[model samples]
Target: MTVSIWQSNLPPLREVDFLIVGAGLVGCTAAYFAAQAGRQVVITDALDVALGASSRNAGFMISSVDVYYHHAIAKYGHDVTREIWHLAKRSQALWYEFINRAGGTVKFQRTGSLLLAESEAEAEDLAQAADAMLADDLNIIHHKTDPLKRGYFAAIEQPDDGAVQPFELVHAIRQQSGVSVIPNNELYHITQHDDKFVTAYTRMFIFKARQVLLCTNAYSPRLHPYFINKVVPTRAQCLVTEPLVAPVLNTCGYSDYGYMYYRMTFDNRLLIGGGRKQNIALENDTTEDRVTDPVQQVLDNYLKRHFPDVTVPVSRRWAGIMGFTPDSLPLVGVLPDMPDVGFAVGFTGHGLSLGAGTAERAVNMMLHGTHPGALDAKRLEPAV
Candidate 1:
């Protein structure tokens, strides 16, 4: 968010109540919650609304974090894992409400999701994950073999998950939030003058805000030094084929231990993403949202190997930046020196799965002084 001295000299200092940085899905949701809390909210973004990962995702509203169920338990502990799953559930519900409130303008489908395994080892992992999920009565089906007959090893089906039009969903939320938006405004710096107000310097205007919440996600590290190591920006690429004669997949299909994901669009196009496992060096720790040949080649080979019937040409290819946290979970807390500035970030590529609920919690924590608990940034603190 580098701004030259000439560009940095904004017109005037604007006073805004509950200023939200970033106008993606989480930012819009934060605005909605803040407005609901009886505050005059204004959202500003570095780019246009929903122009980032929110618009570029496959739009799967799958529950849970980036990892598999039992794997999350091993990494974050059983209680924390359960809490995050509930958070995802809450996020999906919020999205449903937004979709319903849109009066059929937003495209959505209850297509569910299939977490498939590409190898025998992954199959065993899926079995274990299914056992843990079933023990908790999480309403999922465990298939001992590939149900899709797509040459996969095993699968775990989450009946509650769904797909959506990501870009339209953000617009719906923004309209429902009924807040003013300042697009193309990048926040370069933020300073809390006192407990009453925080001043933010942006490309457009210097804002004297009552409270500030950052939904910047992958761009968070660039905004403040506190997020330097906390959020690693990773690039994810995807390609969608032309509309097929018939729909190939009815559900979001995730395989290769969650590295690969594919789903059929509402218009009958096959969208495939995730080759980062094969090209980790090129894909990880970068904010550059441009598809490369290596990753695209992997996706191409995958399509050939799996969905051999799909002969349509590739329609479009794109990339999106995802904020990957050290623990593969979202971070919700205030900055160390600026208590008036709060942030909800680091979704680890599961922004659609957890953004709304995390934003709701972030707004509550910022405005009402409620604790975010497991989602708190304190969880990342080093042991003394």
Candidate 2:
């Protein structure tokens, strides 16, 4: 007999027009907007909600790009990159809008972010990128400032950018409009039919719906083979320091070409993360939720490099896996053969910044069969 993914855990799924897999920020946001539009939605996750990349981040809600403006302009051209940057800004705005509407205990800090440039040449590039953003009438402050103890060449001060408790936002979105969030109910597999999809869940529960959106992000490759070539799982290490006696990091900070980032939590704790580029081979791992000593050492010693005065015991350290794409953009449309199934993945570590807007775009595509150029089917077709 073939063993079932779940033993004696028979749960019933009901009246679900939209079955969304993965209860991270992407999946939860999908459920949020889908139900907000008066659609019956059921969302499932392998683990508890927000336990993935949704919560395991530095929690900067800045509209900054993973592929920064300079690099993006070079790779995808100026026009396409500008459109992508606007979409990223819109994604951050989605968080703020939901936080206001939720009217609950959501932790959102409007702490502006500083993108640092270490070298004079790099600073010039940053200045140009800032000019591009300013030309579009977006909020931007470009100047040479020694904000950090480690003297930087220049910085792009994004005033509208801020930080948010990503887990709270994910939870709040689900809580809105009675979306069914089946946590601890892992989706082991998905069977795509000609007209619909049948999902296999842990605890012997299954659901069929006209539309199924795979918002699983990193683990999306397991359910669909196409993602095996498109999306690659990458590990990100993060840590939180013991409460500081005085405020150390005032606003969200990024440096070294967006490869590293740090921020201050509400309780005067410093949360720092992002060092995958430091050790590409080791950080590319996604097998476990544990942090490697090499990356942890980088976080452990980063304080001395920037703020020598602030010293605190390490409170906690952990790691989470996120999906990456070859092009550093997300795949947010249906597969070529699977008409009834649509999906989104490969955020390239900018999931929080892009999840909500991309999820909303997925909903629009599913509903009206079209969407804005920023997140339409043609831009992110998995095959391409």
Candidate 3:
């Protein structure tokens, strides 16, 4: 099956220099940057624009390594871990630039982030992590004692952390000229032909371009068979509560390291997500918006225990899929052994913060054949 804009009777190809797959954060940002370079670009997605993790996430643009600096140093070495932290900081800066340029009602907030430790041992670990980051001159402040009236043991406030409305930002990027967006376009296969890449889709059209950038995230497994094992798709459940009078959570909060996370929106609605580890096996597959009873119960209990005074009704509950690589880092670089193919996926639930920068790196690599300094390609290289 071949899917092309012109061949499918949708719209003319218009001689695009780049054909980017998946109109989520990565694809849309890639299109914006590619088009900014005065290169004609076409972006397509399997579902509606911003329908994937790009829109389905809690919108936390946290500026920290996947694993804390202390843990990362112990696991991957000091030099590599420091490099990772630098990359994350650079990514955070790029996100601000993106939001400023897009200039939409994207609801970007730099309210910072809080990392709470649920237990004594975890508190010590978190303290060590904070100390490690501080030693490196990072602005992570530690509150040794529990600050919340409800007793969250230890916490670290990351001053540079922030949030953004992913959907609005992606839509704003799409409005840029020279970028053609094709929704409901699914890529099924890719073939190389005389210095160009032709993407065939199950929807019966063929797209030919000088290069194809795969930014499908978890959904990439279906198009690239090898990704099935390399990138594991996991389902995350989240719920939004009805507006509350006073904002209870001032900053985005995450506990148990990266396991459970929640944030308060401008409307005072609490958006909570995580706990896929409870049913890890079941959650490790592709699925639609199905919320598990146990997961919902856990989230409800957390809210009740933490915010006893606030009475907010549960307005909506939903599930989103995120991709996770074995190393718990994003995969951002040219696909090994494939020509003119680049990708930015496997964000491991941290796409909102790093998506734009990674996509920009992928676009730069595709255009100039060199990895951008902002992206730590060495750290994200395929383990195999």
TM-score (all chains, Cα) for each model:
0.97, 0.91, 0.90
Better of 1 and 2 by TM-score: 1
* Candidate 2: regions farther than 4 A off: 1-15, 196-202, 372-384
Which of candidates 1 and 3 is the stronger one according to TM-score? 1
- Residue lDDT tens for model 3, 16-103: 4688888887788788888888787888777867898888888888876677679988877787677667767767887777678777
**Residue-wise lDDT of candidate 1 within 1-384, one digit each (tens)?**
555587555658999989999999999999999999899999999888999899999899999667888888888889999999899999999999999999999999999999999999999999999999999889899999998999999999999999999999999999999997999888888888678889889877889998999999999999988998899999999999999989998899689988999999999999999999999999888998899999999999999999999999999999999999998889999998998899999999999899999999999999889999789998887766
Candidate 2 residue pairs in clash (backbone atoms < 3 Å)? 9-203
Model 2 Cα lDDT, one tens digit per residue, 186-255: 7765655556454444443767677788898888777777677577889998888888987786789687
Q: List lDDT for all candidates, in order.
A: 0.92, 0.77, 0.76
Query: How would you order the candidates by TM-score, starting with the best?
Result: 1, 2, 3
Best by lDDT: 1
Clashes of each: 0, 1, 7
Query: Per-prediction RMSD in angstroms?
Result: 1.6, 2.9, 3.2
Which sections of candidate 3 miss by over 4 Å? Answer: 1-15, 176-178, 202-204, 372-384
Deviation in Å, model 2, residue 119 alpha carbon = 3.0
TM-score of 2: 0.91
